[model samples]
Target: MSKRYIITGAPGTGKSSLLLQLQKEGIHCFSELSRKVIQHQQKLKGNKTPWGDILGFAELIYQKTIEELKSPVNEISFVDRGLADMTAYLTSQSYFIPGYLQHFPYKKYYKNTVFLLPPWKEIYVNDPQRPQTFKEAMQIHEHLIKTYKNLSFNIETLPKTTLTKRKEIILSLI
Candidate 1:
């Protein structure tokens, strides 16, 4: 079975940038689904969005993640985020996490080691897709750490550094 490594963190933490570089290096990578969902909702003027309906947005992301997991992979792959991220987001927003997600066996699909990119204030920025402030991002970061730890996955925080270095670190670790 191919090992599916997960690279996760709060918004604007350079997860996408690192993943892009990794993909350029010929590594199999699954991009984050939330941003895509947001863009699609915006284009369609739909209600499934974080700002409009968070619960609905969570369910959408959950479904997208499930579909992504079903894709065939012959080599070790990296996922931009994992199911626990949805739990973390819901928890941060004070919403009740769904029991289906709460009971899901995340370890059965993802690797035990999850690379958590810490919030970088210097590099963090708000855009059309990512509107979270740096402070909110930090709070979400804490929730992500707690959620993943509670799920019994080894949390590895990627240092705040250049994309090349971060890529090197992940490649070295995995």
Candidate 2:
């Protein structure tokens, strides 16, 4: 079976950077849908939160993730983020998730092994794509880890090290 891995962490923890580096190394990976949607909204509205546009963007992420999971490629695939990340965002922002998702089980779609990068304050930097404060990132990171634990996943925390070392840790775990 094709293994699906989620590379997730607090914002600015190098989730996207590591994924990009892995892709450059010829590893299959998918971009974070939330980042893509956020960028698109920013471009069209000149602001981060384009009021009345988040729901649609969230839905797009949900659909795109499912599509990526069902792709024909039979290689290991790494998702920059995962479905649990979406739920955490909505829940954190006090937005109501659709009823279907409230009862949906995400563990079935992904694998048991989940690689999480801890928040690295030393390298944390806010950018146009990510505007979360350090405290907020920490909260989200804690929430995400709890959420994944609730799903009974085999969680492995990757150290805040060089990209190559992180990749080695993940490879060894899998």
Candidate 3:
């Protein structure tokens, strides 16, 4: 069976940094779509709502991920943020979760384990697009954990540790 892992956390929790490290280690890891989209939007439209851009970009990423997952690959796949993570973000913002998401059998597509990165204040940085405060990141982190638990997923909350240790923990879970 193809194992699909989700590495998720609030903004500034080193989700992207850790995933980039894993990719360097030759692990099959998907990049964070939100950062890319934010960069694109910043270049295209001076300034815009970060949340709105993230929502649209996340949808595109999900489509691309599903397509990629369709083809067989030797190594286990790790998505920086999964579809459920997007739903949780939108839901927390009081946005209606898209109906199509309910149709996708996510459990069938990915492994049951979800690795959640805890909010790390030391690494939190607010750029032009990602202007979230540390408090907000913590709130989002808690919401993500609750959302995944509500969905009955086996979640492992990872601590703020060295990149190598994080990778080792994730590998053990998969």
State which candidate has the highest TM-score. 1
**Per-model C-alpha lDDT, please?**
0.90, 0.77, 0.76
Model 2 lDDT per residue over 58-87, tens place: 677777777776775446778888887766
The candidate, 1 or 3, that scores higher on TM-score is 1
Residue-wise lDDT of candidate 1 within 1-174, one digit each (tens)?
676999999999999999999999898998889989999999998978867899999899988988888898747789888888989988998999998799988988889999999998889889988888898998899999999999999998999999999999999998
Total clashing pairs in model 2: 0
Candidate 1 ranges with C-alpha deviation above 4 Å: none
Question: Among all windows of ten consecutive residues in candidate 3, which has the lowest summed lDDT?
Answer: 46-55
Ranking by TM-score: 1, 2, 3
Error of 2 at 129 (Å): 1.7
Q: Stretches of candidate 2 above 4 Å error? A: 46-54
Task: Give a tens-digit lDDT track for model 3, residues 23-119.
Answer: 8878888777666656777788734344655456556656766776686755577887877776777766777767666566778767788899998
Residue 124 in model 3: shift from native, Å? 0.8
* Alpha-carbon deviation at 81 in model 2, angstroms: 0.5
In order of listing, the candidates' clash counts read 0, 0, 0
Give TM-scores for every candidate, taking all chains together and pairing residue i with residue i. 0.96, 0.87, 0.85
lDDT of 2 at 92: 64
